[model samples]
Target: MSARFAFNHATAKFWDQREAVEACARAGAGIGLWREPVQEMGVAATAKLVRDAGVAVTSLCRAGFFTDPTPAALEDNRRAIDEAAAVGAPVLVLVSGGIPDGGTIDSARDGVRQALAELAPYARERGVTLAIEPLHPMFASDRCVVTTLNEALDLAAPFAPEAVGVVVDTYHVWWDPQVWQGIARAGREGRIASFQFADWVTPLPAGVLTGRGQLGDGCVDFKRYLAEVDATGFTGPIEVELFNDALWARPGAEVFAETKAAFERVTA
Candidate 1:
């Protein structure tokens, strides 16, 4: 079976948000937009534009980061769910926020649990699924505290199918020893909300967060991932979400073309 591809809007940050979406539509690619870009375009307007362009809003880039577990944060996530619903996006990717001041990773995980409990029902009400994305363990200090697909699935276990799920991103999780098992569990539990691809590279870049590689530029067995997820009957859009400075420096159209080519090649 062939894999369908989606482009995360950040991959084309050089272009205006709406223009990026339009470009993806023109390229016959699905779109995964970040919240800020969507806000800049106005949720309703962006939604309408994407719909008019005949493009699929595969997923909203993010909504979680509710580590504070405050009422304000929960409200913000609720609003995010509404925005995703407006854009006809079924999945709202969630990055469980980093460790709070003087807090342990375990404590941060607890905060994520509480945040999910509060927001899952709201997301379900709005017909949006919250997809918990586990960032790389290297980011366990300052990015998402959820650092593995297994942990993410365990976190989403309590929620019903439409309320909570997990996002599997290759850049963040490809190095995990238990990734295969996690993917299988995500499938068995029906928690595979989104599947993102970005190649992994080494050399300890200063800003490790933004140095993702193009699909074929690094060492990732994407075919293995595709086979694992496809075995779960997950035929959802495979989103390319690279954040490499090199790719970003290029023109949006060039980046889009190269990413699409890479997707085709890797999944071939």
Candidate 2:
């Protein structure tokens, strides 16, 4: 078993949270938690569940949407930071929201910067790193505006590395020609708050958000990614986050077994 393997809750979106944590515990794998379920189960209960199971909480997904940066938005992010802290998750993934009705992409990017400035200090105080996740460019208009690892790193640059960092998710960064360089740079700057795995497959399903390919099922070179990230001296959990509708429709235990096997195969 790979000591670094972790299963992201989104990989089995509809699975029961307790069952997921239990599965991770049995496998000696860490777990990435989602906010909705955590809130559903109550933060304290979820914390106790994982603690009793001895399952590591690798990272929390998600708490960004900072393009607008209203007071309400910033408040929500702070709550997210607290949740991450309570769950013992060191990082909280952030997805910059799309451009507002009157804002341009540049302005939206600025909003992200401003929001980080306001949130980084709070996050640092809580011992949580706010990780900026750059979604693919296609999502810029409606999902996320930060579209590359370099851009995410730049957004994180103004803050202390521990307070703000970038998430290197393969589904979003694999298309970048300079991805390897960005990975190396992230390592050098110690800004890699989280490292995630997902593959790219052709003929993407409608609404590409759920089209993430399983490990070894697409074009991404996992071995190379693992080698590069490992060379950076990042010995943290390696989370596999898939958003495939097909997988979500299956029994979560079955999907977990298959995905774990795929991870071992690809990383082997």
Q: Which predicted model would earn the best TM-score?
A: 2
Error of 1 at 50 (Å): 0.6
**Regions of model 1 farther than 4 Å from truth:** 1-3
TM-score of every prediction relative to native: 0.97, 0.99
Across 189-264, the per-residue lDDT of candidate 2 in tens digits comes to: 9999898999999888895999999998899999999999989989999999999999999999999999999999
What's the number of clashes in each of the models? 0, 0
Error of 1 at 55 (Å): 0.4
User: Which pairs clash in model 2?
Assistant: none
lDDT of 1 at 192: 94
Cα lDDT for residue 151, candidate 2: 89
lDDT by residue (1-268, candidate 1, tens digit) is: 2237899988877668877887787878889988898898799899899989999999997877777798888888888999999999999999888888988888988999999988889899999999999998888878799999999988998999789999999988999999999999999999999999999877756777778888887888999999999999999999999887877888888888888888999998
Q: How far off is model 1, as Cα RMSD?
A: 1.2
- Residue-pair clash count for candidate 1: 0
Clashing pairs in 1: none
